[model samples]
Target: MFNSLQDKLDKALQNIQGRGKISEINVAETVKEIRRALVDADVNFKVAKDLTKRVQDKALGQNVLTSITPGQLMTKIVHDELVDLMGGHQEGINLSAKPSIILIAGLQGSGKTTFSGKLANFLKKKKNKNPLLVACDVYRPAAIDQLKVLGSQIGVPVYTEQENLNPVQIAEHAIEHAKQNQQDVIIIDTAGRLAIDEQMMNEIRNVHQFVKPSETLFVVDSMTGQDAVNTAKSFNDVLDYNGVVLTKLDGDTRGGAALTIRTVVEKPIKFISTGEKMDTLEIFYPERMADRILGMGDVVSLVEKAQEQFDEEEAKKLHKKIAKNEFGFDDFLKQIQQIKKMGNMKDLLGMLPGVGKAIKDVDINDDAFKHIEAIIQSMTPEERRKPSLINISRKQRIAKGAGRKLEDINALMKQFEQMGKMMKMMQGPQGKQLMNMMSKGMPGMGGGFPGMGK
Candidate 1:
């Protein structure tokens, strides 16, 4: 999301990398460029000024660390400032209240309803809470049905009063329903107007008071830039929300709202959502985000995501198969499923240290694995388990069955054979040594393209 901003900041820091020593003039010049970058990224003018000024101060005072170059010192200073700017600590939702109520507020099209569903799924799966989603957005057509569909998908129960259009009554009554139904948490989705209308604000404020929520969250569209910050301020003034949720961050390349919202509203961002998938919501971590912004890569987050999809028992079984050279298309398909669950294909690749900036201009399709999966599925069960039997005739049959070309089938076979060889290598002495070396290898390799050296 911090694409252009990262490029500019990286260039600014690189400007002094050749210097033998740190100087005030060079630091000032770098700071000026950073400020310009922040402004161009849609950050509030005053916030950009203040951020760069603080960075300048920190950079000037870093001269005592003489062992480090100016570029490295400035990078450290900027990283620390970014962490501070984005709420130094990660904050979680408040769930202390019995049948804890979480009221979601935001403008229409801000993804408030969808976020409620994702939050319900997260709490139910991760936090071990029985959550009830309250469909309180009665004014919007199909809003109730939308919540119902989301609940059905996640296996969570949704509360709705189809005839009642009053959100306050619906919210208040939903709490009682949750208590009787043994639902430990209640997430109320309020109606959002196209613009901040007086009636809309008053209705939400009333609902907030009636529900007396344990925590209130203001959902914002991150792509809206400065307008998001301004909307957050208005909502904070009325709702006094406990935290913020920045939605559609994957579509937002500027990401100025994420950088500036916390400072503007003085609220911690509890969650950031990317794409429409319910599993794409993530807890906001300031330091990890800062790492991503500076092209340092978020290895920690990437590892955490991988850990989420890792199955210990399955791993042991897969290891045995690999050692025996019995891994086949079925196993390959299982691995693909786990990887798909991690997130979008492109976003997953971008998590690698050097690859994020390197592939910024590349169009890595999310459905790139679909055709490969189809070809594999077209093969007979025995042929899949024993790819050695798939001769030219079989390949042509499978290609016609899968509605793909002979060349595509040939490519898949070649790749699958190469993967089989790789698995065998991993069980050998040399491959084991290479794996160990990679365990201690250069962690964040900066990826480059043909014309990217500039």
Candidate 2:
């Protein structure tokens, strides 16, 4: 998402990397370039200026007149400033009340309802809360149906009063329903207009007063850039939202809203919705985000995602299979499914140090593996288990069955053979020695790539 900004900043910092000392003139030139990068990324003018000013001051103040690389030192300074720009620390939701009401407020097309469902799923899985998603957007029956579908997907109940036109009454009744059903968390999805108007603003304010929510979140589309910041200011004027939820971050967004919203609205960004999946929502961590912006990756978050889907028993079985040269197509398919569950392919790869910048310009479609999956699925049980048994005739049949070319089948088989060899080698005694060497040669590579740590 910060692809352009990262490139520009990298170039700006490169100018100082070879310097033996940090000079005021050189730092000023680098800071000017950084400021230009921020401005071009759609960051607010005042914010970009103030951020560069702070970074420059810090770099100059911390100057030791030694041989420390000015580029790395200044990178840290800019990273810290970026974190402070986006709310220095993570702010969690307030779910203290027995039936905590989280009022959702945003304009249309801001992904308000989607974030509501994702929030419910997150709370249900991570917070152990019985969340009831209330559909209070009486104007759009589609929104009510959408919420119901999402609730069904997440195994959460949806509270809807189809006959009621008043949102305040609907939310109030939903609170009562939550009490009856023992739902500890209540998320109300209110109506939104194409743009902010007095009628819509007053309606949301009334609903806010009636529900007396523990938290009010203003959802915004990050793709809107500066308009997202302006809209947030307007909503904050009336709703005084407790936090912001930036959605559609997975799109081709410059990510200016994430950098500028908190400074403008004086609200914490509690959550960020990456993709459309219910599992795509994540708590906004400023330092980790700053890490990503500086091309350092977010290895901590990457490990957490892996642990969420890692099965100890399955790993042991896979290890045994690898040791015995019995790792078959079934095992490979299982691994693929687990990786798919980790989130978007590009997003997952982006978590690795240096991978994001390497593949930023590549068109990473979510369905990139579909053809490979189809080819694997078309293989017979015996053929999948015993790849060496497949001859040219079998390849032709499988290619036709998968609707792929004969070359594709041959390529897959070749890749599988190479992978089997690698697995066998990795399980051998020599592989253990090599692993020990690597473990001692470089640290943190086992958990994540090197150079990701501060």
RMSD in order of candidates: 2.9, 3.7
Cα lDDT of all candidates, in order? Answer: 0.88, 0.89
lDDT of 2 by residue, 294-395 (tens): 888898999999888999999999899888778888888888888889988877888877888777776778797788899989999998888878999999
Cα error of candidate 2 at position 162, Å: 1.3
* Superposed Cα deviation of residue 406, candidate 1 (Å): 4.1
Per-residue lDDT of 282-382 in model 1, one digit per residue for the tens? 99999989988888888888898999899999999999988888888889999988988999876776677867877877887778789988998999999
Candidate 2: lDDT over CA atoms?
0.89
lDDT of 1: 0.88
- Lowest-scoring 10 consecutive residues by lDDT in candidate 2? 445-454
TM-score of 1: 0.93
